[model samples]
Target: MPGNMVTSEFLVDVDHQRCRRCKRCILNCGFGVFDFQSMTTADSSKCVACHRCVVFCPEEAITIRRNPLAFREHSSWDVDKRKAVWKQAQSPGMILTGMGNDLPWLNVFDHLLIDACQVTNPSIDPLREPMELRTFLGRKPDRVEVVPSDGGYRVQNPPENNIELDIPLIFSGMSYGSVSLNVHKALAIAAEKLGTVMNTGEGGLHQELYPYRDHIIVQCASGRFGVHSDYLNAGVAVEIKIGQGAKPGIGGHLPGEKIGREVSGTRMIPVGTDALSPAPHHDIYSIEDLRQLIYALKEATGYKPISVKIATVHNVAAIASGIARAGADIIYLDGFRGGTGASPAVIRDHVGIPVEIAVAVVDAQLRSEGIRNWVSIIAAGGVRSSADVAKAIALGADAVGVGTAALIAMGCRLCQKCYTGNCSWGIATQKPELVGRLDPDWAAERLVNLVNSWSLELKEVLGALGVNAIESLRGNRERLRSLGLDAATTEIIDVKPAGR
Candidate 1:
């Protein structure tokens, strides 16, 4: 025992004969749970089960298992529920959690089913036929003007500064402080290669990333951590981040320790100061105020497309309508299950609505209010697979924003230690030693491969749906059927049950 053994939750088992004495486990563990001198786990209570030690131990000497703290089991209060009570009783501290909420909530994508062409309609051959996934995200004029020309009828360009993508996918913003520099570089490189956009989250754009400005989408968060004229102009599009899906109606507090030289320069803040973003924008008192900021950014950025990123809440549809009227070219709706670097457990778990429902509702609202074409919808929050992306498109999203999935492709284990700054994978750490774990060149190509794989799957889904283009799938809710959903859910999502 290493002095403190009062709160031992895990039992340590070591095969002493197989121990290699290489100190690999000791060096790999960010949490000081293992003992070097004894060549075994020292304090089991501190272990978060990151599995770094077990995975890194060369000879497979350590085996850590839960102690299964026995307690009188109750029907209402389970072991986990009782343990939570005990932990809270011990200390009155905020439950700081990382990643998305893990509750087994309803995923609208799972319940909904996609329609495929079997006999009546012929399915398009993706390999032979032209399957266009070219997605244009921005405001569209209600109608385009046409004039007779000498050669033919010439159509005038619509008054919209839209961004066209080879695929309906954009790598969502993850700030520099939350992620490593190489991660941003990887996303930027992949976005350029994939002909899409990568968001330069609230942490600001690094000087080295200026070359990829055309493929970037800069975010102006509530904190405005690194908002500058050049920074805004560098990106082709600017996003006004009102709230994220993980922690809606709550501010963010980046600890002072994570602010290093590079981070400070990028964020334009002192190295030792904590970055505090408030819950609400002081300037945005109402929708009118939001419009003023949107136009102001547009003016500053030479009329670039301005996007408003908001969490999917109960009143998201109405809020999105106001944003469209406010002159925003895009509206990004983040669902409740989105990943975050860190957030208060209560807010992350219980704050917002699922993105699938949000996307459907918001799209329906915009179309019903006769403003569907006014702004493009980018659905986000817990977009895990290509199927999820396809489902999102069928539900009415013009595009989907992927964050956690991209990180996972870059070798993230999803240990959720991002806030602790001990990311061994180098994807989410400010420390130089840990950040060196990721190779930008390899990770960038990996991201490109991931997107390419997803694009292929999207095309397959489209071909099955008897559609030759992504536009046909976008907002085609009639092609979707739900399973195991209540009448209200089906009504709100505007999809009929299976075989109905």
Candidate 2:
């Protein structure tokens, strides 16, 4: 097999006349695409189009674009397929990838439209009237009990262990080893600032971030990395990560090279050793078994709201129902398009179902079972904009999680090179030099701004829908309509077709 069988995926052009010999591009790029001996030279084959050089070059002399090299066009045997075959032949191994699925599947959210108030119902102006975005995550009782007070009746019972959010959005879990500590700090700061929560993935919470414990959701993965009594009690809520949407039925491996001193310390693993998480919790084979862990964490955390996270699959609705019945206060549904630090390319692109469908089915199933109030649904994966957040809430999600979008707000370019442990923007890599590039304070500000803008947009959405609060939109399928969606999809989503 020839080593050069795979063609370069990108073309890098550096105009010498405009190049100032500053060497900033070479310094900024984590990938070794540029070399400057006397004059600057580029290895186009090595470029991943991260745009580090293009952005850092003071003279703006660099341009990175897709290679124009053409291959025979075929419906099935596309360029990517051909390239993968060639690369595998040269070096046989499972093809690892990063980020979310990039396939061109139809996004269900795009086909679904939110209905606005007209004629019969009057719309509320968010600017003039109060619009409530505040939401709580926890199990709710069927009814509340009240006793007579001095002046008015007061509620004798209130929901226990509920996590309040000003914006009904969570910063999804991205472990320490998978992403830089600066990213975690930024998320924590932003969550605290915005009155929401940030999840401390399978990686244990770093000691430095303990100050933000009130705004965190600590995870207990199959490997139980960094999980202890202190770790569990540190967060307002605890999450058992049964599966991630990026690679549904597989284990996760954080390469030894990326496990630095801090990562090792936080995860409680030896430095330079690969951190592995088994596909399923060893102790959980059935719903009964899952129930045991959920309660155990609840016990460990003094009965804090327990969350069970699972990947969205064909039977996600059933799985979510089981989780709720098993005493989980929150059911986190991660869709196929969720981002990850490392995942097999084959699994990331092909395995799980879309989150939009999962949210609809799960919400409907839980409602039918009369267990909807038993667990708060947090939908994730492929949530790109404010419209997505609104659609998710309307589809029955109590709150939504944003992973890739948060990273992008923190300067991620979606270059899909995170698994390489050489992130130029400092959002993914643990390397000291690379990590130093990111300022947590600045990144936190960016995140705060992003969420604030989204919250404002959500209010606009609520006002247009003639609702004064986000609570009214929860599982209100009547406020939604399908556009160009097939009958089956429309029915499954429980939204009427346009003009119906």
TM for every model, in the order presented, reads: 0.94, 0.99
Q: What C-alpha lDDT, on a 0 to 100 scale, does residue 206 get in candidate 1?
A: 96
lDDT of 2 at 424: 95
The TM-score measured for candidate 1 stands at 0.94
All candidates: CA RMSD (Å): 2.4, 1.0
Predicted structure with the largest TM-score when compared to the true one? 2
Residues 317-427 of candidate 2 have per-residue lDDT tens digits of 999999999999999999999999999999999999999999999999999998898999999999999999999989999999999999999888898999999999998
Query: Candidate 2 regions off by >4 Å?
Result: 147-151
TM-score of 2: 0.99
> Candidate 1 on 1-500: residue-level lDDT in tens?
33432355566666779988887777776666778665554577766666777878788888878787776778888666666666676677777878887777887888888889999989988999989999999989898888888979887865568898899999998999989999999999999999999998899999999999989999999899889999999988999999999999888888888899999999999997999999998899799999999999988988999999999999999999999999999999999998898898889999999999999999999999999998999999979888899889889999999999999889887767688888767777898977887898899899999999999998999999999999998988888999998899999989989998
Candidate 1 error regions (>4 Å): 1-14, 38-42, 60-67, 146-154
Winning model by lDDT: 2
Report the lDDT of model 2 for residue 145. 93
